[model samples]
Target: MPGTPGKGEEMASDLSQSLPKRTFKYQSSLPPLPVPSLENSLSKYLEAVRPFASEDEFKATVQIVRKFQDGVGKVLHYKLLQRAKTKKNWLEEWWFDTAYLEVRIPSQLNVNFGGPGPYLEHCWPPAEGTCLERASLLIWHTLQYWNLLLTERLAPQKAGKTPLDMDQFRMLFCTCKVPGVMKDTIHNYFKTEREGPCPSHLAVMCHGRIFTFDALCDGEILTPPELLRQLRFVKDRCEGEPEGDGVAALTSEERTRWAKAREHLINIDPHNKTILETIQSSLFIISLDETKPYSTPENYTNMTLEALTGNPTLRWGDKSYNLLVFSDGTFGSNCDHAPYDAMVLVSMCWYVDQQLRLTDGKWKSTLMQTVIDCGNVHFVR
Candidate 1:
């Protein structure tokens, strides 16, 4: 009885037996990542240093490594083993915090990925009077793809017929990196199928002004026509009102500097913290850019660089994704790389591209007439 399987384990075994084996089926059965022997590690290190070190230096380094392996290293190795015994993946948390959260560089140029939208040859080409129209369609398709991820309907991604890890895809929506002094943290609002509620609000930026409105109404994502109406309201207000102070510029500063500035701003006024929280919690940022398209794939590189670093005022550098809609209906994305990899964005963009091609970039049937409230986020210095 002491070694017998429990009810949960028996059920899990039965389910595994009944279901057809597929990609990721054996994920839980994989062996834990092995830790290398200290002797082996030191031997490899000595081999690597031989070419770079003088003979005398190599001898001294070898002696140092020998002492380390015989002393502190053994204690540390035992601690690591104890940690491995308690943790499923010992390196995951350390890797994320060290590689992303603890880095002091500005995330825009250092940790963000930017690329142009794939709409040139497809149904939507560079043209006037198509910016909002194309943007609505793109948003609709993007939401549909997001729904797929939410429902776990997306097929497992693969490379050369081998199934790849799908964990990063879950971070594509409602994820942002919150800045801190020593280490930042990722705030993710994503939920698995049948898990819980996910954030459905979208942030829109125009002329340095930020707005937030629900992208879903009555348990349904807004139709493209409804999205168009919301975009028109933000665009028209931006055209009429003077540009507000670009608080988003502070995010592009060096990590420590931004952290200090953020603290000072929050101290000056508590409302600033609330605004920061709002932006961080939103699903994603949609930038209604006033610039025209570069009109060529080769020029996309420049466009992407601009989208990454162009206007600190109009872009949230820490958001997982910033959808930039140019005046000529061309689009691009500036994405922070902390929560996920570039492949997630690529997959979503590809889905939107294929949907656009299938429908010729036109919304079918009667447009929705719902009027949604969109408000500008005001910040006080």
Candidate 2:
């Protein structure tokens, strides 16, 4: 009966049988980009940040923050340009490239983030002349600014779009570290070489991001050396056309390497204990870029969190909860200094909580009461 079939018909049957079945649902199309309201709200938000500092201190702080933004923004902007320039006949590819540097500049600068004291954000006790406090304040301001920029990017002006989540927040956090640390370390190291920033090496680890900038500076100049700058942002080798630009498909050999690296990162560092704990139990790491082959130690934490949040199996204590919320969520607050920097973290949490409330219906007014009340006021330790 098969031999008796027509030649054209049989060929069609065989071809259809050999092809894989298409079982997945087809996605119709991507929706248009959202138009966020934050663009209009940004000015208002920043203006609100102003009254938190005195007129003189606020003006000086604004200038310093601007300079900091300009310096770091230039580096980031130029890096993007250089990357585009290197692609073979890159002009053709420019239209498709959407990379951008989002900058966050705070409206005010205050050392009393923790409570009513001379602390940078909280009650850690200010160092001599309050240099450490000021430097920490700068770092906090810059970080907050970056978050604002990111929040603006993810504004829910468009339909069917959700606000940006923790993963995007993580990307911004990592990227800002280089510039933020560099700015702080340079300002503080020269200003107070005798006391240094911290009393111990642990301080160095806590603020290690600053070291990247220090390593960039040779000695005489504040700017990074040309070689270091080139190394950090430039990519000479072509990674080749990759799939999805999200989570890269890895080979068996590569997987083994990643497994080993993960173990080392989780087991080796005492300073990273909090980060490791999050990874072992309740942190989620979603891939921001899928096409690239590179991965971060952060991914391990993300992978674990994919299953463990609010799960009964994992019993994270007060310390763990605070760490997870502080690190994972964009919301910042004042808290115990033992697990995290209560000074910076507390202020950040308070700021974020206030901001989020503003976005939600809970806060009736545009200006946060805390901003006015807590401005220059310290939290009781």
Candidate 3:
């Protein structure tokens, strides 16, 4: 399983009834990443090195390049071809470890990428005092997106008819990066409807406390009002209680240090291990921060700053995605770069922003009524 790309969650073909298996079927049929020829590789390497070297240094580098290309480089290239004979993507494992997991630094602002929620422009932002409400509404939309993946309704992404790798989309939910003494590992708990039962719970972090509840009730996705109730309960529960131990901040520490801390935490208390799994297995984390980091169309500096680097203790930085809900009803996200690239988040943001514009930050689906006691609020925007 080490070199395998997709989490061995592929659907079986012996089923009696046909189902939507396009997501994986196409991926399986598509070509594996091709290995470039040695000449191209060394030529590009020399081109890259040329810009950083002076005339004499460049000449020396060229001589070294030629000697290596004709000598050791050729041998290495032969070995690479032998390795490729057994594996389709020979570069995946090494590239993954070298580029991400083997790095020891804290992931926050260094390796992770985040920014202000661009959905705030053009009357698209939520009003004041509706942070929880707006968050619930946003969660509902996000769940819908998850359902798209589950049902295989989401079309495969492409670059001018050439399909792009859709593996990262699997990491969008129910995924967390687990730290180790030497390297980190990604744990993805998501399962498509065809793959069988998966975690439907949602985790909320507030006041340095973590809380989780099922995002689905009676086998149906929770309505906006229902989600609002859960969010409100988390808010009320954290308000009067003493602050929690803030274990999440440990995820913001160096990888090796965090790994040791996690080990000690589990060793001291069996319950601590369960708590960690509950979070890692959930859909994702929703962070309720007290600061507004107020933003406007002209200036998103404060919000962007808060989202990328604010409140080290408030978020589980290793989670695949952390939806940051500010006190003033705006939004942003911080995510682990282990399982996916930033473009996936950008595409999701674009989809949700367009969907929000269509519905005005609310849903037009069923279970729309004044249910919660919060002044008989109507869910219909």
- Least accurate 10 contiguous residues by lDDT in model 3: 1-10
Q: Higher TM-score: candidate 1 or 2?
A: 1
Q: Per-residue lDDT for 15-90 in model 2, tens only? A: 1233232111111232322323332334454577797988897787667656755687456556655664554333
lDDT of 1 at 259: 88
Tens-digit lDDT track of model 3 for 24-83: 457776786677999998899999998899999999999999999999999999999889
What is the Cα-based lDDT of residue 69 in candidate 3?
92
The segments of candidate 1 whose C-alpha lies over 4 angstroms from its true place after superposition are 1-31, 36-79, 158-163, 293-295, 365-381
The digit string of per-residue lDDT tens for model 1 on 139-235 reads 8778776766665556666677656677788788888888889888898887755677877778888887888877766656676777888788788
Instruction: Compute each candidate's TM-score over C-alphas.
Output: 0.80, 0.18, 0.89
lDDT of 3: 0.78
lDDT at position 29, candidate 3: 65
Q: Given candidate 3, what's the lDDT at residue 85?
A: 83
| Whole-model lDDT per candidate | 0.76, 0.25, 0.78
lDDT of 2 at 259: 37
Residue 128 error for model 2, in Å?
6.3
